[model samples]
Structures are given as structure tokens and as C-alpha cells.
Target: MSAELEGYEQDYAVLTAEITGRIGKVPRLVGDEKKLMILNVEKQLDEARELLEQMDLEVREIPVQSRSMYSNRMRSYKQEMSKLDTDFKRSRIAYSDEVRNELLGDDGNSSESQRAHLLDNTERLERSSRRLQAGYQVAVETEQIGQGILENLSQDREKIQRARERLRETDTNLGKSSRVLTGMLRRIIQNRVLVVILGIFIVFTIIMAIYFSIRRH
Candidate 1:
């Protein structure tokens, strides 16, 4: 599961970076408001992607019994992400088509109707381009956010592993302490028994001396 998520994140990052870099290069070609809107969309996409990545991280941390809920939510988020990609591509293609048609129609004609047509197509192209630009920004931000999240998750795994190793070491130390205590207790019992035997022998010797002295008297 971890490997799959990592692979997906890597691919997402690469694709997103390429798309966003491409859009960023075209800032000169787009209006200021369109560019700002695109950047805003990029931020939103980053947040959305961060949200999804956090959930996936939680899935790994949560108990096995409750992972199904997160898994379902992830699936839904994935569907939404896919839809966003589709809409983005579709809008770009549409805008490109409009621009191509407008260019083709601008062949030395100076009629009022031709000017109006150009104006209309130009407006349409701008709108479509803004939409496309926004989507592109969003896609790129998503990948960046995803890559960041994966890195965090990796760090958390390392922490958990280190904690487990410490716990094992503690258990081993406790076992050694227990054996040492047992050996000490065994020696204490043996010393007590030896003391008792020595005391009995001293008492017997004194009693025998008293009995012989009384008989002599």
C-alpha cells in the first residue's frame, strides 16, 4: 500500500510540475486578472490535494477496523480529481480551436462584420483561456502538495519504527534485570539456610559441654 501511494505521488508531482511550468511561462500572453485567477485556482487545488494526502496519511495511522471510511473518502476524492482533469483538458482544446478559427478568418478583410467576428472570438478565447489557465494552475499545485504530504508520511513512518526499536530495547533490559534479581534471591535463601545450620551446631556443642561439666561436679 505504501509503495503504491508513493509511486502515484511521484507521477502526480512530475505531471503537475510540467503543466504549471507551462502555464507560468504563458503569463505574458494572458491578462492580469486571468493570471491572478489562475494563481488563486492553483492555491485552491493545493489545499484540496493537501486535504486528500492528509487523509491518506491518516489511513495508514488509523486502526484497521476504521480504515474503510477513509478508503471510501479517498475513492470519492479521486473521482473528483479525475473530473477536474477532464474539464481542464476539454476547456484548453476548446479555446485553442476558437483561437485557430479567429486567426484563419483575419485574412486582410476590413469589413465591419469581420471586425465584429474577430472581437467576439477574441472575447471567447480570453474566457476559455482563463478557464484553462486556472485549471492548469490547480493541477500543478495539487502535485506539489501531494509530494509534500508523501514526505511527511515518510517521516512519520521513520518515527514509529524508531519508537518500536526503543520499546524492544527496554523490554530486553527489563528481562536482564529480572534474571539478576532472581539470582540474588536464590543466594539469599541459601545463606539463610547455612546460618541456621551453623547456629544449631554451636548450640549442640554448648549443651554437650554443660552435660559433661555437671556429671564431673
Candidate 2:
């Protein structure tokens, strides 16, 4: 691999690692802090995408005999980037749900006043009940969405594992091919040396025969 491509791969690894670490911190954060972290992660993701594009270009310039390995690496990087993006989205949704729950909780003022007002008015109580029902429906939908995200994450993990296994297999095959080629090369060099030695021997024998014939004549 060329030096340029190797540098890009290193940069991509670092950037992705940073993004992953930041994403992990998001759930621990709240309010503006979480928002800022998410924005930063998004920007880093864009950079990561650009790096992948650069890597793809570099891989294309490589010779076909060696390009498959680099191409596979690129695919793995892309899959990782996709997984990171999905995790970021999930984090945002979780943060939103957390904030929503906080707001929906019974605080001292608003919730208490509503309860007192409901006691005095039947119509208001009915309205409050309907709102609660709608909130319950939203909660159910959110739970379903969260479940789907979990399933997708599991699938992505499997794909990454398969990709890793394929890469290892490719490396093993390349190693075997290298050893075979080296052995073939060694044999070819030895054959050439033997051929040169035989040629010289044949020439010397002819020279001796000619000299002997001249001396005898």
C-alpha cells in the first residue's frame, strides 16, 4: 500500500474512535451539553465520511492484484461509519425521551394546580385524561422504535464480525500466495544458474575438441 493511503487509514481510525467515545458520553450528558456533543459527533462523522471517500479513491488507484484487500477495508470502514451514525441518532432519541419524561412528570406547581383545577371541573378532568392517553400512545410508539433500533444494532454487529473474518481469511490467503511465489522465484533463479553452467561446460568441451583436433592434424 502507498504511504498516502496508509495515512488516511490512520486518520480514519482515530476520528472514528473519537466519535465513538463521544457518543458513549452523550447519555451521561443533559440539555445543552448533550446537544453540543451531538453536533460535534455529527461533524466528526462528516469528516469520517470524507476520509472514506479519500480511501476509496486511493484504493481505485492501486493495482487490481492488491486492490481487493484495500476495497474490503473500505467496506468495513463504511459499515463502521454507518453504525456510528445510527448510534448517534438513537442517542438523540433517547435524550429527547428523557427530556419529555422530565417535562411530563408532576412538578410542584403546574401538575399540582392542574390536579386542584380538575377537582373543581369535570370537563377539565376529562381533557386531562385524554392527554394522558395520548402520552401513553406516544410512549408505546417510542418503545417500538427503540426495539427496532436494538435489532438493527444487533444485525450491524453481526455484519462487522463477518467482515472481520473475511479480512483475516484474505490475509491468510495472501500470505500463502506470497510463500508460493517466493518458492517459484527461487526455483527459477536456480534453474537459470544451472543453465549457464551447462552452457559454459558445453563450450569448453567444444574448445578442447577443436584444440586437440588441431594438434593432431
Candidate 3:
């Protein structure tokens, strides 16, 4: 698997474990049917985690030899973006600083033509700065968007783990209850034929009493 993808998987598993371990204690401690809702949530979480893991595996199957290759690529893209952005900002700052210096009458050692030429330089600088700044902003925004997606995936993994823990607790409780109920039912119905015959006899007796009272009246 690709290193980046493996990193993502490890991160997801760790975060998921942490979140579920925190939330999963409630059902285990309480041991109530009311907490059964937690079981449903747990199932949903399990499915989501499975899906995410599968997706990660699928994405990482491309098999790259070096982990740093992708890291280097990402790092280079980010560095380039940062450098460009900084250069644009510095250019803008320099333009303003030059203008301020000139306006303050620091061009005393120069002629009017040279001073006018400074404005020309400033105009070009301003335009160049704006273009570079725009590109830089775009790059930063894209990086932020990518980070946000990673955070979201992590959050999803967390949700699923919590759910799985809850469902497990519920299943344990459910198994216990099922066994108890089965035993109770079996005990109550131990003498099935005798109970049925006794019930029929009592019903017959009641009917006979009712008939005899009516005839005497």
C-alpha cells in the first residue's frame, strides 16, 4: 500500500479507538435495555468504518516504492506555494515602502525624471504583487480544503468506533437476557399436558355451576 494511504489508515484507527473507548463504557456499566439505541448507532459505526477501511485499501493499491516520494511531492507543492505567496507580499510591501520614502522627499540626490520612474516601478510592482498574491491565496485555500477533508474522515471514523462499542455491549446484554428468558419459559411450561388438562377441567366446572343455577331459578 501507498505510504500516504497507510498513514491515513493508522491515523483513522487510532482516533477511532480513542473515541469509542471513551463513549462505550456507558452501556457496559448501565446494562439496560434503554441503552439499546446505542447498539443501532454502534452498528452504523461499524459499517462506516468498514467502508472507510475498504476505500483506503482500494486507494492505496497503486503500490509506490517510496513513501517519501508522495510526501516530497506534497511538500514541494506546499513550499512552492508558500514561496510564491511570500514573494508577492514582500514585493507589495517593498512597493509601499519605496513610495513612502519617495513621498517623504528622500530622492534629494536624484532628478524629477528618476523620481517619476520610481512611480512606474511601483505600478509594475503593484500589478505583479496582486497577481502573485492571488495565486498564493488560491494555493493556501486548496491546502486548507485538503486538510479539512482529512479531518472529516477522521471524525467519521470516530463516530463508527463509538457505535461499534455500544452495539457490542448491547449484544452481550441481549444474549444474557435471551438465555434467562428461555430458561424461565421452559420452567413455566414444564408440565404442558397436565396444565392444559387442569385448565379444561376448571372451565368445565364453572360451566356446570352456571347451568345448574339457571335450571334451579
Candidate 4:
């Protein structure tokens, strides 16, 4: 391979490794962050593939007896890249599959967890309310010492209420993000399949052209 081709191959290899590493961890990631990471890696892979395709065309134009050898090398590089691309796609699908199950809450575990938390908080709030009422009555019946206790309980209740609101907002955001991610993943998979189909058509066209040319000669 030419120095330029060698350099391109090296860059492709490095990029593939980087992308593969990120994809491997996709299952561990969640929400929009995971989608963003996949998109970034996909962009990088696209740029690298474009460069490789350019190199492939250039290699095919080399006017020498060893042109066939160079072409073989180019094909090898493209095959490697194709395998890497497939692997990356499989990783993405695997991650999406895992996250889809989580989103569906297949076992009701997530709902159960949320229910348990709500129940716990409700019980705590009930207890706090009783204490506050008792403290208010104590203050009315006795001295002003219960006023201070009531104030503390009121502050605690406000904090807990704010926390629950924040938790609900977070859950809503996560649900929205998951739905968006699933849509994006489906679109990506469809596009990839279309690309593969288009590639096959192009290859078939090329073979036919070459075959007709040989027959005419």
C-alpha cells in the first residue's frame, strides 16, 4: 500500500477501536447521553468510511502491472471496515434492545420501586402531620416550646415535598428521553438496511456492466 493508504488504514483502525469501545459500553449508558454518544461515534465512522472510499477509488486508477494487487488490498480494507460497521450496528441494536426492556418495565420492578418509595414517603408524611398537629395542640395547651418543634417539622415537610416533585419531573424526563431514543434507533436501523440494499444493487449493476463488456469483446 502507498504511504497515504497506509496512513488511512491506520486512522481507520484507530477510529474503529475508539468507536467499538464506546459501543461496548452503550448498554451501561442511559437516556439522551447514550444516544448522543452513539451519534458522535456514527459521525466519526462516516467520515472515516468516506475517506476510505476515496482511497479505494484512487487505488483502482493506478496504471501499473501491480494494480490488481493494490485493488485486492483496497478490497481487504473495505471488507474490514464493513465488518467493523456491522459490529458497531449490532452493538447499537443490542443496547437498544436492553434499554427497550427497561422502558417497558417488563417485570414491573421499576413501578414497584416507585410505589414503595411513594408509600414510604406517604407514611412518613402522615407521621409528620400527626406530630405537627400534636405539637400545635401542645403549644395551645401549654407553653411556646412546641412552636419550635412545629416549625422544624414544617421545614422538613417542605423539603420532602420539593424532593418528590423533583423526582416526578426526573421520571417524566427519562420516559420522554427513552421514547425519543427508541424512535431514533428504529430510524437508524432502517437507514442502515436501506444502505445495505442499495450497496447490493450497485454491486450487481457493476457486475452486469463488466459481464456485458466482456461478451461484446
TM-score to true structure, per model: 0.46, 0.46, 0.34, 0.43
Give the range where candidate 2 is weakest over 10 consecutive residues by summed lDDT.
Answer: 92-101
In order, candidate lDDTs are: 0.62, 0.77, 0.56, 0.71
Q: Write the per-residue lDDT of candidate 3 for residues 13-125, one digit (tens) a residue.
A: 56455434434433233325424534544554454356354533444343333433543444443344334333333333233444455555775445556656766776676
| Predicted candidate 4 versus true structure: per-residue lDDT over 1-217, tens digit per residue | 5687777767877887887787687666787987998888789889877877777656644544456676556656655665566556555544355665777657756555665676666556556755664574454334333444676798899999999999999999999999999999999999999999999999999999999999999
Q: What would the per-residue lDDT of candidate 1 be over residues 1-217, giving only the tens digit for each residue?
A: 4555556555555655554554444333335754564566466456557655755664555445455565565666555654554444333323343444464575534544665676677667657766775685466447545756887899899999999999999999999999999999999999999999999999999999999999999
Candidate 3 TM-score, true structure as reference: 0.34
lDDT for 20 in candidate 1 is 51
lDDT: which candidate is best?
A: 2
**Candidate 4 TM-score to native:** 0.43
lDDT of 2 at 115: 48
Candidate 4 — what's its lDDT? 0.71
Error of 4 at 165 (Å): 96
lDDT of 4 at 107: 74
Q: Which residue segments of model 1 deviate by more than 4 Å?
A: 1-110
lDDT (10s digit) by residue, model 2, range 31-105: 798889989998999999899878877876775546557756775786687678667765654434455457666
Which window of ten consecutive residues has the lowest lDDT sum in model 3? Answer: 86-95
lDDT of 4 at 17: 80
